[model samples]
Target: MKARRQRLILEIIRQQVIETQEELAEALRAAGFPVTQATVSRDIRELGLVKVPGEGNIFRYAAPGETPPLRRDERLKRLLRSSVQFMDFSENLVVVKTLPGEAQGVASAIDQASWPEVIGTVAGDDTILVIVKPKKLVTTVLQRLNELARG
Candidate 1:
C-alpha cells in the first residue's frame, strides 16, 4: 500500500505542480487515497521528492534523479558544485564542509570519483574527512576539490 501510494504521489507530482504537503494530500484524497498531511509528508520523503525551482520563482516537488545510473557522475558533479562550502587539508586528511545534510552525498560523490589521491572518505552531517594516499598528495587532492567546487 505504501509503495502504491508513493507511486501515485510521484505520478501526481509529475502531472501537476504540487507545491505543498497540503496540496499533495488534497490530490491524494481526490485520487481516493484518504491521506493526511503527515502521511503525505512521509510519503514525499520516502519518495525522495525534492522541491526545485519552477515557473515564476515557485518550487514544486519532483522525483530525484538517482533512478538513472548513467547520470550519477553528472549528479555528483552538480551536487559538489552546489553544496561544497569550504575545503582544507592537513597532512593526508582533506576536510570538506557542505550545507547541512549534504555531507554524505558529497562524500559519496568524492568516493565515486575514484581519484588516485583519495584513500577514502568519512562524512558527517556537514563535514567530510577525506583520506589521501600520501601526505604529499594532500595539495593535489585539495586542488581537485577546489576545481569541483568552482565548476
Candidate 2:
C-alpha cells in the first residue's frame, strides 16, 4: 500500500511543478488515490523527497535526480547503512570492507554515487577497491568513510 502511494506521488510530481502538500494531495485525489496531506507528508519523508528552489523564492517537490547531488546522497546513505562494514583509503584508492558476499552491492552503490573524486570500483567477496583521483584527497576520503561507518 505504501509503495503504491509512493509511486503515485512520484508520478504526480513527474507531471507538474508540485508546490505544496495541499496541491500534491489534490493531485493524488484527482488521480484516485484518496489521500490526505498527512499521508502525503509521510510519503514525502519516506521517499527522501526534498524541495528545490524554483523561480522567485518558490520551491518545488522534486523527485531525486531532477536536481543535482540529492539523489546520490540518498542512495549513498542507504547503501552505506546496509552493506559497508568498514572503509579506508590509501594513495588514490579507497578500500571498502563489507560483510562476506556484500562487497559487490556496496561497490555498485558507490559507483552510482557519482562522487567527483571517485574514478571506479572493483569488488571481491568482502572488499571493494575504489579508485580515486587527486591523491592528496586520500585522507579526506578516509575520514569521510570513517564517518559513514560511525553513523
Best by TM-score: 2
Residue pairs in collision within model 1: none
Off by over 4 Å in 2: 1-60, 63-68
Top lDDT hit = 1
- Report, for every candidate in turn, its global Cα lDDT versus the true structure: 0.83, 0.78
Among all windows of 10 consecutive residues in model 2, the one with the lowest summed lDDT is 67-76
Model 1: CA > 4 A from native: 1-73
What CA RMSD would you report for each candidate?
11.1, 11.2
**Whole-model lDDT, model 2:** 0.78
Per-residue lDDT tens digits for candidate 1, residues 15-71, read: 888899999999999999998878987888887798876655687887996232224
Model 2's number of clashes is: 0
- For all predicted structures, in order, the TM-scores are 0.52, 0.54
